[model samples]
Target: MASNGMESMQLAEDQIKILEENFNRVSKHPDESTLMLIAAESGLTEEETAKWFRLRNAQWRQAEGLPAQLGSVKD
Candidate 1:
């Protein structure tokens, strides 16, 4: 579990690039184990990785003119 304030920390450029590459290869919402591996590689907590995915997915959906509820794990 992560501390509340930990969510505000920014990832380094390399970490963001790595994450972006993986995101492009994978679905917007990756499975838990894959997410954990990504978190480890990106030097982010699982919470931050999840949050980033959530936000990025929302942005992607908006750009595609899709509803936010579509193609989400929560659906």
Candidate 2:
């Protein structure tokens, strides 16, 4: 069971790497339509996509002294 769980995690990590690469290639711009379509194709709900967007934005915001708290934005 432990090995199976580890294998699953590894597979998920590999898949995420592939997806990130593909997304980077396709996501030339951070347009809403494109990201939403990609999110749908990538099996992400709008909420999940929003959360990811907020988190990514927050990381950048933190560097620039912008608000990035989870409560500061909707997920």
Candidate 3:
């Protein structure tokens, strides 16, 4: 059971790494196709990928002293 928990944590860490790499290199507010690609790469569902982006954006905005609101992706 403890091993299972550790595996889960490691999996989560791997997923986060994938997501973070895409978020930094790609668009923070990715389009549907981009989101799908990222989700597939991260081994996450589309909804989960979207939620991760949303939460990450909020965290970044807070860190930058901006309001935690959704913003349009730059072209």
lDDT of 3: 0.78
Off by over 4 Å in 2: 1-11, 14-31, 69-75
Error of 3 at 17 (Å): 0.3
- Candidate 1 residue pairs that clash: none
Per-residue lDDT tens digits of candidate 2, residues 1-75? 123122233325544554465445764334777667756765666555544555445555667796655464253
The digit string of per-residue lDDT tens for model 1 on 1-75 reads 334332455778898887888889976779999999999999889988888887667667768998855753572
lDDT of 3 by residue, 1-75 (tens): 123222233348789899989989998889999999999999989977887787778778878999877556532
Ranked by lDDT from best down, the candidates are 3, 1, 2
Cα misplacement distance, residue 41 of candidate 1 (Å): 0.4
Candidate 2 CA-lDDT value: 0.52
In angstroms, give how far residue 30 of model 2 lies from its true place. 3.9
lDDT of each: 0.77, 0.52, 0.78
Task: Give candidate 1's TM-score.
Answer: 0.76
Candidate 1 minimal-lDDT segment of 10 residues: 1-10
Superposed model 3: Cα runs more than 4 Å off: 1-11, 71-75
With candidate 3 superimposed using the best TM-score fit, by how many Å does residue 75's alpha carbon deviate from the native? 21
